[model samples]
Target: MEGSAVRHFTPFWFSVEPVDTLAVRGAPALLNCSAHSDTPARVDWKKDGTFLNLASDDRRQLLPDGSLLITSVVHSKHNKPDEGVYQCEASIESLGTISSRTARLTVADGDGGSPGGWLRAVPLAIGRAPALHLCTPASVEGSHAVERWLFSH
Candidate 1:
């Protein structure tokens, strides 16, 4: 066995974990997740501690890079399906599964009682000078457009 090449297997690990995100109702949202390992890994997702079946859900898509994409955020007084805590799980046949940090998705209602309206402002603090946080949609197409503004009064 002289001059034989030895292969070192790297343990599976998450390189990019999903982060908390806020999406306007009827807009798309994405939860990023990336993993690395010596063996090919399969990716799955969980919502509210329950396994999410992306195959049955038409509005949801699992990207090739292990990211979950919501075609449209669904939120209403009667039904809010897209807003929940989510986690990404990666697994290999020979290795145990590894889970990423939990990320929460929040759906915000549109202003003026509209569903697709993209302008909203939240007051962070109220004092002699109030701080306002505003999120507006950008003019980009096919991309998640979010513009934030901080105003100190």
Candidate 2:
């Protein structure tokens, strides 16, 4: 994309799919974000409009491929300033900044010990629908191409 340079320039950005939202409390989660481009830029992890400290002693880590890992995350932590919305903003030099679809992290009822906890989730279900990813994750993540099956319904 080429154009005249005005006072400021905004780059053509990328897009994230309709996110598969999760509702859980006191459990670790990883928000998977995969990019189609390799342009070096900054990716921000934000919770409730503020910068999330990914380097804290908490197991939360910012994966290099653009995913967020929330270790031992509690639902109580998400209900206030941290409990609202989480967004992944990617900024590229030529492409400016774009964000992932905001994920509404909610508190789930009951403990996460249900036998169905490991069942097919609402968004991705192998039994209900044959799953096919339009774009697959890169070859970096160890289990990128592997798909597991569960027959006990």
Candidate 3:
């Protein structure tokens, strides 16, 4: 043994994934992304701008060199006319192609409650100062009705 010592390696980041906004319309939603290679890779998918050709369409499966499998995501009826923008592009040619920052599938314009649908819940499902009726001794207007805050809880 002639003293064996060797330590020199560098790698801050080689893989990073986080692009799949949200979707919920006709069910069936799976939009995941992953990338980062060294020797094996072949993930390339696109949408919105259009460029997603899974050979034809056998489920668009591929989970070896990371992920990016989005199959069956039908959501486009709110306002119609093509609806909002939905994009997802990811390529891998030896650490190249990185276009994934647009994921938005919002199709909410039917079952939101009923009759005007609560105005479509502002700020993402009700946020404009909800919950009313308060009391503190300054209760001199309807005597703080509504069963005292619905039985105090």
Candidate 4:
């Protein structure tokens, strides 16, 4: 076995998976996805169980890092296009393909009302000084991350 060389192979896997996100109407949204493999893997996206063609849609862009960026979310009473379940797929030649967890993109109105309703804040007294901290009001159901993103935009 002297001077012999051996090669190890690594299969395709997702390092960063997309998560459920709440996007505001007419605001930018991002679905994070990252994959790795011994060979170069091409990343694609699926929306509502159908293959998404990023080129056909001008509003959608696939970032260099494999993340999908939606320039503007479209949602209305009669027409809703961006609200659906999404999944990222990574594939390498001769290695087949692997899919990430399904993440849902919910579109909310731009009126500051989320699926979780309005966010409330309460004053906490700390040694005679009151500090305002964000607290989920009753009937609120969503992550702080989503809430922060919603308000930030």
On TM-score, the leading prediction is 1
Candidate lDDT values, in order = 0.77, 0.54, 0.41, 0.73
Residue 122 CA displacement from its true place in model 4, Å = 22
**Per-model TM-score on C-alpha atoms:** 0.70, 0.54, 0.26, 0.70
Model 1 shows how many backbone clashes? Answer: 0
lDDT of 4 by residue, 8-120 (tens): 67677998888887666777778888898878889999999998999899999998778898987888998888999999999887778999999998776755464445422
Worst 10 residues of 3 by lDDT: 121-130
Off by over 4 Å in 1: 1-8, 112-153
Residue-wise C-alpha lDDT for candidate 1, range 1-153, written one tens digit per residue? 799977666688998888887766776777889899877899999999999999999999999989998987788999999999999999987668999999988777855343333434343445322232354444454676655565543
Find the number of clashing residue pairs for candidate 4.
0
Which residue pairs in candidate 1 have backbone atoms (N, alpha carbon, C) closer than 3 angstroms, thus clashing? none
In the range 1-153, model 3's lDDT, one tens digit per residue, is 369866444222225443433333332333445554444445555556676666677645545544444454444444342234444444544344556555544433334432322212111213212121222233346655232321110
User: What shift in Å separates residue 18 of candidate 1 from its native position after superposition?
Assistant: 0.7
**TM-score for candidate 1:** 0.70
Per-structure clash totals for the candidates? 0, 2, 0, 0
User: Higher TM-score: candidate 1 or 4?
Assistant: 1
User: What local lDDT score does residue 151 receive in model 3, on the 0 to 100 scale?
Assistant: 14
How high is the lDDT of residue 37 in model 1? 86
* Structural RMSD, model 3: 13.6
Point out the higher-scoring one by lDDT: 1 or 2.
Answer: 1
